[model samples]
Target chain A: MLISSIYKIPIVILLLSGSLFFLGLYPDISTIIGGVALFLIGMEYMEGGFKAFSGSFLEKILEKFTNTTPKAISTGFFTTALVQSSSLVSIIIISFLSAELISLTSAVGVIFGSNIGTTTTAWLVSLFGLKIKISIYAMPMIIVGIFIPMFLKESSWKGIASILIGLGIIFLGIGYMKEGFEILKEGIDLAQYAMSGYAGIFTYVLVGIIATIVIQSSSATMAIIITALATGQIEYTNALALAIGANLGTTVTAVLAALKSNENGKRLAVAHFIFNMTTGIIAIVFIYQLAELVDYIAMIIGIGIKNYTLKLALFHTIFNVIGVIVVSPFIGTLVAFLNKLFVSKKQSKGKSKYLDDSALGLPSTALSAVIMETKHLYENAFGIIARGLNLKKKNILSSMDLDDVVADLYTSDTIDIDDFYNYWIKGIYGEIIDFSTKAQINMAPEYAEELYKLKLANRDIVEAIKGTKHLQKNLLKYTSGRNRYIKEQYDDIRKSLAKLLRNIHTISTSNEEDVIILLLSKSKIHAERDDIIANGTLDRLIRKGLINNQMATSLMNDSDYAYRISQNLIAMAEVLFIDIDSDLKKLHVDMGISDEEAKSIVQKKDHS
Target chain B: MSIKKFIESVKASLNLNKFEQKGKKKAIKRLLQKLESRKEILAKIHKKKLKKKDLKELREEQEIVDLQIKKGKKLLDELDG
Candidate 1:
């Protein structure tokens, strides 16, 4: 990984100084540097276009296609080529793994494929970018890219336009780079610096690594290498070494990116590092042999003998493919080692489990992480509220009758609601809120809205816990007291809440929209029935003088607390559970039981 | 042709019109089938001579399902239109 602490700035400055020193000696240096900058900028634009274009398509494809190791590798290869960015592919894979949307094995497989897929850049530069009249195609592509957006308002159109523009700019940069190397050749041949034998190969490999590290882009470096090799500025053998070095250099970026990621991302980073290191070494040790093999293949493929650019591209691809083939069989062993290498620290009850910084890289991943973390928060809140009711969580989640659940007290003594809330609710809620705030910055509008709803659902969960804390005080006092009527009423309160909890548990697990909706509607009706005043339970008890004013007041206030708990939990469930399907989401909006309908249902119950 | 026009032609050629509408209709039909099955389950329970509480809850569930089916059918008709 790139150094993150105090040494980072100095290394960057030193790399810049070294790059400038080589360029300072030549008049064409400015053009070379400018071309690199343009290449990097073009890469950025292309990555942005692909990301914008993907929306949900890439995520769905990645999820669907990564069911097996080979399929995952192919998916990784095809996706990276299509988007023209291995880093972007890596980022998405990291986010997906962090969100638990894909397995670590599948992620590593894709990373392997992306290595081969990335070789396509070298082929592109050698075949079309350098061999053609760059400006002729570049200008028209840039023009058409700019013009398409004017007439088409769709974002997808904008995405296609950006892609055209990015490709055009990349071609222009290669053209400029080709010219810079051509001019530099007249002053002094860079080929003279190329070392012979192992000494030269090792030296150039180190130079390649440094070049890629300095440029912070292996793709740009590869383009530079290919253009220079094509222009005969550097010998082909040194270019091969540099290609190996460039492969090693990209792992530095992956490692740095993974530094901010979760354990899955860290494991994948190590996997990437291992893959590249192994490939680099193997390619370096057999460089001459590999070169001869490349020549034999090139002849059969009809490439000219002097076409070192195409040969280098072929070499770049061959080594990576060899790396994949060599290392792929050991992937099972590698995954086992990596899994043991980066164990997720055993977190506390209240710690955020799914809100890691990796998922924040993508809007969908961020949203998925927040949703999952919200569920974790809900589980914690569920335990706190159930304990507040003095009901065992296992019993409530079970198929046990609600009345039986009420009788099955969690403990004989009063539970500390405050302590449980602090232990399981406070820290996680704060982290989710903080993570959501950071995540919403780059989120699409609809995703931002979903995050907003999840935030509210999180709040609703906390509010229910608070309501439980309020209800728990009188609940313990009255349920254990000598007054049979008051005790029965308290037990009734416990039963009502247990039923609500049980119904939500069912809704949470059920995918059937009808069942979820019906259960949610039934819970709403039950919540309204909890209104002691509206239901005449309070009036009748008071009229009979079954309870004193003091008891009555306690009963009234505690009933309201119980009612609030049901209300909050139901609202949270509606948001979290109903989001399983888009159709269900629309149906929930259009046909969810309104408050008035709930009241009407309770009134009908009263009449009966 | 204009880029927008060309996109429209492509969409038409792909038969990609009203993709969401088709999905919505399919979802509604699936939900209606589930509700009908649920109704049948309830009807079986109603005939079993259940206790007063069970019967009352069952009656309420039936009413809710019937109302949902009516709404679903209405929504499907509107989508078709």
Candidate 2:
């Protein structure tokens, strides 16, 4: 608490102190300050304008393109270059990571590309702003940008105008900073204070970091360094060190963005930090070699040796390219290392495994995810139902005869169905429903119908489990009692359910759909025949005096529960497993009997 | 009768005592009505000569209904035994 309170001292005081220090050092401090303010404002407008213009389309493109590492890297590079802000790209990558749209490795790849993308600003400033009187162009651009937005009706066109204005203001800000640096050069040459060793590199690097932290933009700091270099206010060596510092400093944006995100987001942010810092270290270590290479490359391309600003741009590009080359081979190891560094919190067993916010945007993917999660729910329900019937799941799923398994178990263990429902089924079931509902919006009608059927199938599975719970009480009582007839009847219920489960397991694993349909149809008929009400089994048992009124009543009720369990399970299986085949679905529609009709046929035959 | 006995009689007369039996009867009635409709559909399909494309569909439907009827008769024997 004490530390927090002490840290809460206003940041404005620090800013004021820094401004006063700069004011004492340079007479044109106001120009520099105004330039910085305008540059930051331009960055904000550019970010907002790009986001408004692209909307969700950029996200769709990101998702679609980021299938592999190389593609992800290129996508990241182009996106950041277009937006003119690596920080915006970094934040978007973090959001994508949080949503599970992109893997951590892919996100790291994008972050690497963004570092290179950010160098575009340095090239733009050196090639245009330093050589020409860019403020003249800036004035007309701002005028046209303002007028264009007013004439345009569409918000996206207005956003484009805002971007144009932002770019113009950014150039104008660079011009102001260059003018201020030129005046400061006459009064004081900061190059005189520049030392000639690693100390100088370290000091200048620290300055670069502080400037970027204050400005919240590495691109702006790079522009400043380039302008100072062009005016001979700072040495080339110090400028190189400053560029490295700016690279390291940009990770603060990702870290801040990841603060409100999930573990995956945090992992991506840390990966960004690691990539930049590693690249910065490598650049610093080989700074002289890199500068010599940049000069050679520039000469080969027919550039003058005296053009330090252009040489700086070449250095920026070369060092980042070297970073990508060095880091690309180690990505797998890096991903492994990152995975260990930011270990995710272990999810509770109740959470849905496949349903994530990212999948909701893609209709087909979301449908498959829901199906996977529902299958997970079914597995849990299967366990509950198996335990409730006092049969082992392994035996039920295996080739062992269910009748033998039920007969072998003389005593039925009591199961707490409510506890099972609460622990496993309820949370995931609710999530699947919620996810499917959200996924259904903006989807094609047929896909929406598919999702609706999946929802019903999930409901049926839960209902089957509930039916098992209802049957469990009487099943335990009658199976363990001395009444042979009731015991045999309850065992029959258990055997039938086990067989149904075994059939489903077989159909799930097998590839033959026709055989599965036939088996399912036969099982459906068997389930209807096994019901005591339509079959008059309860009435005959009552008349024969094999059981008393109370016992008969319990048996009849429990039999209905068992029959409903089987019916629901079969219905759920039909929807989940068989409905995927369009041809079979059409065939079934033409040929299959409705549930009501099936039940009625049984009732009519019993009456006859 | 005494007051408690009189209240019990009132409850029994209200069909509260035989609620399970009442529920069973209602279910059976619904099932019987559904079977009658299905039987009528089957008879109509048999009476009209179906097109070549629909003949296989009619045959498949008849097969499913036959399976239901066969299963239902076995259940009837078990119930009426």
Candidate 3:
């Protein structure tokens, strides 16, 4: 509750207060803070731009490319490099993992590649930006970027323009940070504060982590470290430690993002944290040896020893590469370990199993996911209905005669239908409706229609449960009593409904389209013909003095409930289990007998 | 065999003629056919060999057959006396 209240404070207000505090403490470093903010915002814009331009397309590509470990790694590396934000890639991967679009092993592979891909920023800053007056180009790029997006009405063009503008702002941010650091060199020599050996590396690593966490962007932290190192504002060893810290800090973003996600998301987040922390520890342990290796590699590449910024980039790349190489072979084992560490809890009532935010953007996947979840809802409702009718689920689903199963049965224990609905049906049903609402955006008409039908099917399942809940009250009262006629009448209702459920189960499990359709139609007909009110069973019972007026009233209401439960279940089956195309559905609608006709046929039989 | 007796024999073989014992034999025959057809459709659906349109048509056909079987049984029960 406290944490939630803390989040309730608008982010803008938090940013304002945080900025105020920093401004008061380090008036001279205010520019650096502003630069960091701009850099982070720039990263957001770029991520948004990429998502807006190629969100669905990229998701498709991600699904296609992540078939194997090596492919997943390269895809991750390339996507992060393209977007210039490993956090973005990680979030996307987390979303995909939650959606079950990728395996845990493949998601872990992507995390490894993202770590390697993040090194591209360090390389870009060291080899290119520091070598030239990048701000000169940043100014024109920003102007052009703004103008192009403003003039263009197309979303795709606007997305491209946003990308250009984001890049320009990033370059501009780097220029400000570099200038601020240079000014700080004259005001205070941070080099004097830097401790000498392992202690210095440890302290600098901690500083790096804090800075990256504060900024929420490891790339921004890397830029600041590289810039400070270039101007001799910090020692080389400390900068390397800071680089390791930055790598570790990036996992914080993923951890926070996965907080509300499903179990898969949580597992992926833990895997990322472990990978980054282990790699950071390895870097710290072998700092000197790694430094020597970097020096040797720089010499071979003709980079001067004094070019510490590029050499720092080289170290960043090497350590991450080493981490990937060491960890790649054990990805399967790592996934298993992660699975054990974070065992998925049995699905409690109310949580959705298949509706993830990632699938919302993809129409077909969204449809299938909702269908699967609706089926889950039906299963829960099925359990409720079985208990409501005082029948065992196993027996109803078994090959045993439903009549025999329901015949000798008296009410054993009264189930709290309200409690069951609250636990199992309400939450998941709401989530499916919410997810479908979100998914309907930008969907093709046919897919939208499919979603609409799925939503209706979910409604029918819930309604069936509600109907069962209504029936349970008197169902318990009469079924367990000694009144032979009332008990028999109620038992008849139970048997009829149980038979419908059994037939639905059979149809759902059966693969033969012909059989499923036949069973579904049969269930529908039985539901229609078996109506107690239409058959005048209650009237006959009352007239014959077999049941009292009070008993007849209860029987009539409970009978209606039974009829609705059967009707809703059959309708749900039609929408969920039947895998017919739109054309055939239309044809079936056109040619098939209506419910009214079926009712009339029953009436005609009575008249005859 | 006369034409009427021959027709009676064929109807008896098909289990569609006798009403005195109710439609029990006819109901059983329809039930068995419906169950068999259901099995075949389920097999095709499992194999993923059936086209979507054909599957829809088959399912509808199955439903009609099921309704027929159900109504036949109900009618037979009503005629049991």
Per-residue accuracy of model 1 over A1-608 as CA lDDT, tens digit each: 22222322444355445457767666576567667766776776777677666745677888899989899999988988888888778777877877678888999999999899999999988888888877578889889999766655455667788888988888788877888888878877888877789998988888888887767778988999998898788888989999999999888866875676678878988999999999999999999999999999999999999999999999999999999999999999999999999987888888988888766666777877888899999999989888898999999999988888888889989999899999998999999999999999966566788889999999999999998888889889999899999999999999998999889999988877888989998999889988887899999999999998999999999999888888899989988977643578867866677878889978986887
Q: Candidate 3: where is the Cα deviation over 4 Å? A: A1-28, A139-158, A251-262, A300-304, A348-351, A356-427, A434-608, B1-81
Order of candidate numbers by DockQ, starting with the best: 1, 3, 2
Candidate 2 local lDDT, A145-240, one digit each (tens): 786654443456666877888888887888888988888888878889877688988998888888776656677788888988999988888899
lDDT score for residue A566 of model 3: 82
The DockQ values of the predictions, listed in order, are: 0.31, 0.02, 0.07
DockQ winner, 1 or 3: 1
- Which segments of candidate 2 are over 4 A away from where they belong? A1-27, A137-162, A252-261, A352-608, B1-81
Residue-level lDDT for A34 in candidate 2: 55
Which candidate leads in TM-score? 1
Residue A505 in model 2: shift from native, Å? 18
**Which is superior by lDDT, 2 or 3?**
3
Residue clash pairs of candidate 3: A511-B42, A512-B41, A512-B42, A513-B41, A515-B38, A517-B59, A517-B63, A518-B62, A518-B63
The true-versus-predicted C-alpha distance at residue A256 of model 2, in Å, is: 6.3
By summed lDDT, the worst window of 10 consecutive residues in model 2 chain A runs over A1-10
